[model samples]
Target chain A: MLIRKPNPIRSSEITSKDNYLNRREFIRAGAASGAIAGASLSAPAALAAVIPDEPLAKLADIRKPSPFSTDETLTSYDDVTTYNNFYEFGTGKDDPHRNARDFEPQPWSIKVDGHAENTGTFHLEDFVKPHTLEERIYRMRCVEAWSMVIPWVGIPLADVLKALKPTSKAKFVAFETLYDPKRMPGQRRRVLDWPYREGLTIAEAMHPLTILAVGLYGEVLPNQNGAPLRLVVPWKYGFKGIKSIVRIRFMSRMPQTSWNLSAPHEYGFYANVNPEVDHPRWSQARERRIGSGLFAAKQPTLMFNGYAEEVASLYDGLDLRRNY
Target chain B: MNINTRIRYVLKPLVFVLALLPAAFVVTDLFEITGRLGANPVEEILDRFGNWGLRFMMLALAVTPLRRVTGLAWIARFRRMIGLFAFFYIAMHFAVWLVLDQGLYLPGIGEDIAKRPFITIGMLALVLLTAMALTSTAGMRRRLGKRWNQLHTSAYAVGILGVWHYWWQVKADILEPLIYAVILSALLGHRLWHRRARSQGVTPRLRANQGAG
Candidate 1:
């Protein structure tokens, strides 16, 4: 139901040539011309006021918010969050967003702890607002075996980590999602071990590819997709990139994540998207692009999602199969 | 005699046709989801088919309670056929997922279930259904006897698993799966309660000293 609304920001920003009104128009023009697609999001910041909120809203927003943005990026909450990654909400590619409206995002604060110099209870908005939204086109591969190209608006994880610098011994990063039985009814049942937990190697956490994204397409993150904030690691299986984050922990040892602990043989911490390492029941040779038909052609799964130039060094010399 | 024979004749075909419905819906929906149906339309189709599978499985589990309440003993006759159809559509769901969607590749399917918990539970439900179907024949039922009953009891487990698999897969919306869960749980609960009462129905009395007399 929520997925049908046209993006609010797109509706407002695409109204006209109002230079002082918004920056989105300029960004759109820039991206259209292939000039500066990944640069600023709107028309040079000079054209927003003149453009009324007609075609788009000021902010747009979903599953796995990208850390990058361009005119091609989605810029509305309806498009962004309503299209999400929460598994309990349902498993259709877009089901989470459609079903996640009731999840109240306010009264939200994440517990920040574990091997950190700066430790305290942080309100979700306080953490989310400080960062400028940059749109990065990311390759999202769900463990459920589908893929999508998402343009997200978020700050680097490095930046977030910098603020809450971990102690020297912090060798891994772990996050927990909200586990309330009332809101997250799925947690009430034992499908997984209640609240979801996911972790990453320290180097993977520090990689430029890792992001603590706030918005996607162009709006604030939607509830189904882990509203307000979630992690984006383009190199790992989607599960390694957890959702609905409520806690951030830095530890010396690898965190025993929900999936890994649930079934160790199947889900390893180094769940890099490797085609060579076969899961017990199925192979990871290829992925079905989400928009494609069920019988649509399959695309070969790339190591580190073809981001090896960016992330392979993180696992240098380590056998991904064993780690996986 | 006429009444009894007529009831059997009608019930025989009804079970067969009711059993085919799940398979029919899944196959038709797979085609719809695969064809150029719009995104929302395809999503609706996939979702509805899944619902039907769940509903039919619940319906099959409803047999005992339904038979007790309505005194329609013939309803019990349909349970196996309905169960097999439940497994059949579940197989279709797997095929759509592995063959058509994932191209029958193992890694993609694993990654999917591994990455997505919903897929994991969904696959588990399918696995349970498959096991139940494999042991569904009269031969296996007789060979295993009590174990067969214990094994087929997994139908309840599979049905619950199906509800959860469907429920968790949704991201934001949840009303539909929740409703299905309630109905299945109620039906299963009735069977459980009934069985518990039946097992305690008669306590053995001590044979008094009347043996000598």
Candidate 2:
């Protein structure tokens, strides 16, 4: 039951393979020469002019425009795929795009562990077979004071968690990204503790809004965008949406996350997008919308990235300032 | 052409254009005239300017040491132009942060300068560079006399602060900043050795063309 919606515009129609591939080769050659001016200027510029509009691998039977989808302007496919902070690929903003070109996302499988009844490794297709994929246009706000509106295609995490039949002892859900240094070159350097990890309280994990995204913009997830599978929690900061997940565990207690482990003072576990709690290095009150023109003014960061109405009650009594 | 004429007419202008190339690239990227910027163009523009500013400042500092070591007194002639370019790039960095990134938000700017250590150090470096740039003229140099040397000595301080600012601002991967630190250390370290040798009245071979300034 592999569900896939036919794409109206084929990728080849938008930009021929030879056209973009030659450009990529030229940029790669420019980059290897250590010419910073040529690499930085020409690479992104060439990408802008001829960004491929075709979806890589169309997901089957995606329900269009979910009730949870936002009506906001979508960040272009170019920006969404080209600009990423996937440190597993590299730390530079464009490093993921440049470095992750060779990563293979197929033949993927997930290991389910902890107190869950289905405590074994399952094929990716099997895991996704039971759920109906839905489109959720989420507002992704990064802790670095930038944002993107992404239309993700995935199934609800709640339905998946319910099917797994977590035991009463399961109070938290822990996730781990694939940790193959051969595949993920950035892991070779100790960027933020390898095999990037993230977790959520059982309640938050089971929230209706929480989704495990497999694709974006109705296409197969690009490797840089965490291909195969990634988490999408609209209410939280973008870092919380861990990418390229390989493990899901039912934890009895709070599980350690990568960023919180890296710099506890800067990134809290519950990385809800609260404008008031400023990052020590920069203000969190405003965020520049990615793909917005150079002169576009930064928009005021919203509470819970504008999902406070849906999720504020999750932390009714807790002080976010202290927790943050 | 004579070496002096070539340097003044051809080489100096070449260096000026070379220095301006980074800014030109940024301008084109900002307008998407050539290549487009990354997802966040402001961040890209800010970083390009800051990186170039740091580079020019490094070049400014290197002029004296290079001239001393290579016995090239002509190198000193380009120091002012390089230093001014450093100031220009850094000012543009500050301008982008103020206008495009911060959107002319006074409170945010004020808080960043006051609260963030990196921003604070960066601002201090800019202020020092500004003072040096203002007094860089020949007339001001004559008027300030010996005091001019004292004021320009803050260039070393600016170098240190510039590196420190970059070091602190990075999220992770301090490799780039660490390289700057090592380069700055070597430049300043050469100066320290030269001073020590001068005081001992035993000039090293590398100090052959010293006192060009």
Residue-level lDDT of model 2, residues B1-213, one tens digit each, is 998999999999999999899988887876778897777888988999999999999999999888888877788889999999999999999999999988898988999999999999999999999999999999998898878888898999999999999999788789999999999999999888888888899866655332223
Q: Cα-based RMSD of the predictions, in order?
A: 12.3, 13.2
Q: Which stretches of candidate 1 lie over 4 Å from their true place?
A: A1-57, A60-95, B1-20, B23-99, B102-213
What fraction of correct interface contacts does each candidate retain?
0.18, 0.79
| Candidate 1 lDDT by residue in tens digits, B1-213 | 575686578766776786676556545655665332333223444555576678779878887777777765566767777777777767766665566565666765666788766778788888878878888887887788777777777787888889988876553346778898889879977766665665787422321111100
Question: Which predicted model would earn the best TM-score?
Answer: 2
Give me the displacement of residue A174 in model 2, in angstroms: 0.9
Model 1, position B133: C-alpha lDDT score: 84
Candidate 2: where is the Cα deviation over 4 Å?
A1-55, B31-33, B206-213
Name every residue pair that clashes in candidate 2: A3-A60, A3-A61, A4-A59, A4-A60, A4-A61, A45-B35, A45-B36
Tens digits of lDDT, candidate 2, A1-324: 212223312443566654764465456445444443454575543222111223376665688778788999999999999998999999998988889888988777677778988565556765675677898999999999899999998889999999889999999999989988899999898867767889999999999899999888887888899988899999899999999998898999998888888888999989999999999898899999998887899899999999988899999999999887
Model-by-model DockQ, in order? 0.17, 0.53
